[model samples]
Target: MSFLHLLAKKSKRRNVKLLRHLQDVASIAMKIARNGGLDERIAYIGAILHDIGKASTQFQKTLDVNFRRPPGMVFRHEIASLFFLSLVDEQDRPAVIEMVVAHHKSIFKDIGEMGLLDLNDRLRDCFEVHAVGFDIWMPNALEILHHLGLKVNPITKEVARKSFEAAVSYCEVKRIGYSKWKGLLMAADHLASDMESEVGDILPKLFITPDLNFYNQQSIWYPLSFIPGNDPRKHTLLKAGTGTGKTYFLLKRCTGRIFYILPFQASINAMYERIKKDLMDTDAEIHLLHAASLLQGNGESLKEKVLQRHIGASIKILTPYQLASLVYATKGYEALITDLAGCDVILDEIHTYSEDAQALVLKIVEILYSLNCRIHIGTATMPTALYNHLLQIMGGKEQVYDVSLPDNVLDTFDRHIIHKAEKIEDLGPTIRDAIKDGLKILIVVNTVERAQKLYRWLNKENLNVDKMLIHSRFKRSSRRALERLLQNDFNRKEKPCWVVATQVVEVSLDISFDLMITDVAPIDALIQRFGRINRIRNAHTIGKYKDIYVLPPPKNNRDARPYKLEVLRRTYDLLPEGELLQERKLQELIDKVYPEIEAPNIDLNAAFVAGKWRIRELYHAPKSALLDKLDIDTVPCIIESDVKLYELADNAIRLDMEIPVSYKILSFKNFPQLKIGNHPFVIPDGAYDVDEGLIAASLKLESVQ
Candidate 1:
């Protein structure tokens, strides 16, 4: 066989001869394996043989325009790769075979049920004689191996059959489980496959950062700047105030690729811009991930999606839940986990998630810790119990860099005066008075229905201020418009206006108000809400300490599904009324309200625990459907009357018209939906006011009755 005849097909990303793919992948795997302290030779050999099966005639024919495989002759080159494992040393054979067979598919799956992966049945026909000649294709494969400086004995029917049996035996031994070598092979293959024509441009290094100190120009608070930079070998946990430069602090410690996680999309969108503009000193690549990642208007091209998922980047700004897909072992989880292993993960605003989400976050921390990832957790509010739990997860206190802001640094950020209110409506006079005084005011409600109701009441009063309303229920396009307005006008506004919002405004938008009125929530949540008022830490402002009125929570448990009534009561009682809201008091209040770990229900936990030991679970790439059970129920919907909006959604350029509403009010299965590409756009037969957003169809039907 000719040397070139043994080569695999050319890569779609670059025009190099296919032989280079295996060599490049081996080089990268060696580097990664060495970094993780694993046997680099095993990694190198695993990568070298991963795609060797592609040298078979059947696979090459698939590349031919006029050729097709004979009926019942399926192409499963990953399985075919096992036929070449005879070249590997017996000691390294298990690792190499595991990486080769599972490179494209799972080794632990029900191979007997999979048509292509069922080695016993699928191999018989391929090995059988054809009209032209004997169908054994190992000659070209061995020639290619020899060209690459490897020697393999001749392939006989008995030798090939024995090699396949050895591979299956290695998989049956669960002691091997998931290995870093396998992860490295997956990462290396993706990186090599994505190399653009010039292979020299893609280096064997880990990640890139600018040489200059990016933090020197900003006036960093004490302790924040004083904390030692991260040691990639250890884990880190930190607590600091809102305006204390925590984001910059965390970025300073990152040694390799970064995964900066936040809770909400609005926060992630805002952070994506901040990182790109301020933190990026070089032309380092970065990607934004969320439900709207595929949205077109964000300058996202189809090519970028391929590059982002496989080629990866130096940094990625996303929600923690995006990384939680690994727990479910979702499709492409291996690639995601490979990119994350040994990387710097900055988890911000971790206290804002729901109970199930919180459980999932802790699971993520446990998994990332096992994967040798450098975890840096930053929080503005964390209960002592939760802090201790995280420390335990990192192997007691010794293994983690436990850092917090000094008292002097914390004292400077004390900017709020708290007051208790009998009812939210009772604060209407206070809001009107603040508006009359030409003070920019922000009112935060616990629910979307309440936010809309309050907005309508305030508009009817006609307080003569430019008023705006925002909540999670607004369409994606409308929410973006509203966020833009908040950033442009209210963020540093010279004029007075009232912005009524829900908890969506709590975490990441850069808007500061002269005064705030909010419903009673957990102390941690309340602190996040209070952050929006006087957020920039301007000490000498006209109103040095802004006023915040906390309305009592709903009287009954039924109306308090969004928040825990007991926690809210404790939060209200512990807050110092008629005095400045000390950031230091936040920890004490949070500890009293949430002392124990919050996790998903018994059933969900059981499901996760049951699959924990099943090796097949790791290979099972489930869909996003797994998230439906984990997330707080919300459904994506569009207003039925908006024809132009539907057309825009159909084009899938921007999802500004799709909004997420409570699934409790709308049955997910009953909605009349349209599939635009991968996204499902639902049309609800309910009155949708520009200001109120989507009214639940069930509510509309009840009204009609």
Candidate 2:
């Protein structure tokens, strides 16, 4: 048989044998490295030598179906790849070896297991066939090297041998910056291995900016009246009221690939669809990325989804958690960081995140700044302190284009009349009256328990109106369905319904209502909830149905965990009563509610420093098979009560039904009950409601301990 043909990789799943998957990886790695402006030759060499150990007969036998594999025999192909490093020059061997070993796992972690501590026995164990003393794989390795146009240099052979022998005691590999060089090789390997089927590039080719001329010329609904008019290539800080075309403004200002980040999946999904529809030009691909991104019927094949990770589309509408991969150093985060460098990012609705998330968001800003990303922050409720901090990071006000609506323009956009009450229970009669009056109502609570309770109470009252309840805990499929229904139902001109929800409805969802009643939350969150009411206004309905009812913080301190009680109290005290909610006062109110720039109990600088250190520390560590552990915060789990229901889940479609069980929930001992096979189920029967979603109390299951 020919040497090149003998070096082929046989895939049991696929019906084709490649000359070698390593060659394909090398080809792809070279392309990626050149595109990233790194040395393509080094990348190709690293890719070619990465899996040279698989050429061994013992490894080949392990691939045979009928072969009896030994129990304790572990074939570390990566370690074997280093044996042929002598084929390369002495100057390039260390970097090439780092790429080979660090591709699958970190070199720092697997050094002992890889046998750098005992070179001769390790070489014998890896290369010598069972019961055979001589290395038989060397001839095939030489054949493969000859076929790849690489000649073994006699001078470097002795040098490589000395280097390898010296490494038996201690191996010191040179530091290749984590985000670029090594990351590029890993990304190329992943992209090549996963690109099983043929697919076209779906990346966006959009460069046309959405200036005032485009908005005025394209449609009458979105007139260019109250948004920042700046060049798409500059850094921008935009402040505009709700319903003022902030999304349009952000999109219009992006000159390259865009990462439109929002706080909620509901919001991100909404933005994804909105951008996809508005652009409807086949020039660019707009992808929605979140936990349940695949489940959203985009008709993306498994191969396409995997490809998109390495070669991102023109625009990605995702939550900030997706960017958290960089901080966590998740596998393939290198690809994400590469995609994000020098890209235009829009951090929309920046005021709606939690304390921890808010801290992470700031840290992300720091990282993106260092990566030279053009960040445009848009928020209606941004505090002066936070804006100033971001401005300083972006090279101060001179570098950032500050965009805000004029006082008269802001007044014209004023559409909300704010009012406060001690409790929502007292507003039951008023809510019933509004339903009779045919006003669409939005009620937002701090917790799912509170939302479900409010939903049931209204149901028991026999309020004759259509009701839809939404929260975070619903099955992935159910939440998606409800979100679509809510969007469609609310858009209908004559629909007068009640949507009982938690903070899920705060940002990104395009639905607007005539009235909103929400529990006491942080001032910024309250403002975000208020944005949902009187959100879509016109000349005829400028100030009509602009009423919003806010319940004051509870007298008891127990309910304050979801939000700071002091902040809520201060926000409630400062809100205008029976008067137009001025947009100018938003920053002042936010500053007052959050006296310190950082949220209480969150040290932003400390978390950022720790994250920076961890990224550096993990650069040489072995790759973890469990990527979920590297995820920033949440843990996704399959939740189902019935064994039959869980059994019905086919492997292909099961991910659509999975839900993220927060880390806080999993920390409790025996907290979740019922397991379908090996996967943890968050609740048993009666916990997940078709309408209200997975009840918060049901997550605390305790039994069969």
Candidate 3:
């Protein structure tokens, strides 16, 4: 049948809604003419015949009154029309085919990697168009075969190629009314498919509208001067005190999608709460994905749908290792590949990673770079070695600039309390004294075994053990549960306890302690761990000052901890006595200390990663491999709702209080002590509550005297 006859049949439905669509198409064509990509005529011609295939009876199966059919059937007419157009002429076929084929996808090619990605100097470009190259599509030759004495035009190879180029050109010119043509077709098509009773089938409908203007409100991020240079393509190394708001800086300036990666589930929980509070009014889809976010809520994939809906959101909160999972991913990476391209990534607490995990992240960064992902390394106390690695990963700061807090704002850092202890034995007493004195303490220890030992000891001391112990020994679910408890405002009667933790607490968990008796380490790490205490406002200046005490070595210490421990021993030995170390001076001290550690290559990029160990390495590349063993698989990640994993711990001390509508996420008969602390945790004990928070702070202590 002739193309005209098909359009005539289309009009028979009484509300063929496309005539209005034709006008819309004409306006778009006019815009194209004025702006000029190919000629205004190409857009008009493409728009007019975009749905010529609606001439087919195949679409009538679903197209009823009000077009109660889905948009797909009607949209297919563009295919038929392209075939019809190819029958006109070779040259016309190529050009017409180009416009028709590409018009529908609204293919965004010119915004090469979100536009201004500097592909000329950076990773990649023009992917959307390149993804549809000439090899994939060819211009069709115009030819007609008489079937039943009727003329039929067939789509040929040449038609595909021209249509592809025209599609790209449309985006390049940003044709004045291109949105109108696209909108009209999309809107008409949807109107045709809508189940309206009165109106007949409509054309596919699309409209042009700007995103909501809510992002423009100016807010105070920092002293403003502490903000880093805004180079999206360059890597930035930041080392600040906790309250300096490193995450806040990264999140605030983050324009496109953001990937905030933390090490553990506990850290993720703390970061998640902060992000939720910060983005409460904003439209960003802040995801708390780990093992928990993947939980199938309400029996329907409502969370999954939200994930899909805003996969390209303004901001996404996730685990850093999850991005690591993607680095060497095979199946799940498909959907995420495009989303991650050119995205800005903020990795918190890099030093907290174990040698194994650190190796994984280093590899992850390398892969992200190849994928055209922009990275911004954020740490409360970024280690010297890490800073160098980040600079290298960002391909060097010769092109990138650094921004830090001014000495003046940093000098105002008389807010912290530092106490030097000689041994780990000294750590407990110091922290106990501080907590008894109403100073919430955060203690950072080197090992998981040590964290557990400290927790038990502090519990024996009748210190509130509930506020203590955040480490890897506990299941991730338990760790997240624990962080929530620590962050809550306990009653005046209840002891606001101290947390004894491994490095897990240092990086992303948002809770803070009043006084921290941390074993000293690198200056950057010391500053980061201090972020947990008095983070929001100034220090509490009542009664005894809640000082962030750094535990010093014994009077005659023999064995000290490892690198972290050694760093702390050296730094702790420097303090004469109680010193109110400011953030900037400490930062300068760290700069001086880590000079040897601040290097990109780290001596062996391939060797450190080449060891044999725990994590199951599955996906492989030339020099790197995906550590599958470390990966907590999301597919089987969830256990039965009644499984013991979700059940409360047996020894948890129960506290009966009306949990807030928000806080009461999971409730049970014997819920593990997320916040139910019976004994008191001494504030002076600080971040190293033994098993709870540590490593992330860059601290360690003398083994013994």
lDDT of 1 by residue, 183-236 (tens): 777777776676544344545224454332575335533347666574543778
Report, for all candidates in order, the number of backbone clashes. 1, 7, 82
Ranked candidates (lDDT, high to low): 1, 2, 3
Name the lDDT value of residue 574 in candidate 3.
59
> What's the TM-score of every candidate structure?
0.80, 0.84, 0.53
Error of 1 at 326 (Å): 3.8
- The local distance difference test score of each candidate is 0.69, 0.66, 0.46
The alpha-carbon deviation from the true structure for residue 49 of candidate 2, after best TM-score superposition, in angstroms, is 2.8
**Ten contiguous residues with the weakest lDDT in model 3:** 654-663
RMSD of each: 5.4, 4.8, 15.3
Candidate 2: C-alpha lDDT: 0.66
User: Where is model 1 poorest over a 10-residue stretch in terms of lDDT?
Assistant: 126-135
Candidate 3 residue lDDT tens string, 279-303: 6665555555543333212222332
Candidate 1 positional error at 353, Å: 1.7
lDDT (Cα) of model 1: 0.69
Model 1 Cα displacement at 340 (Å)? Answer: 2.3
> Which pairs clash inside model 1?
477-656
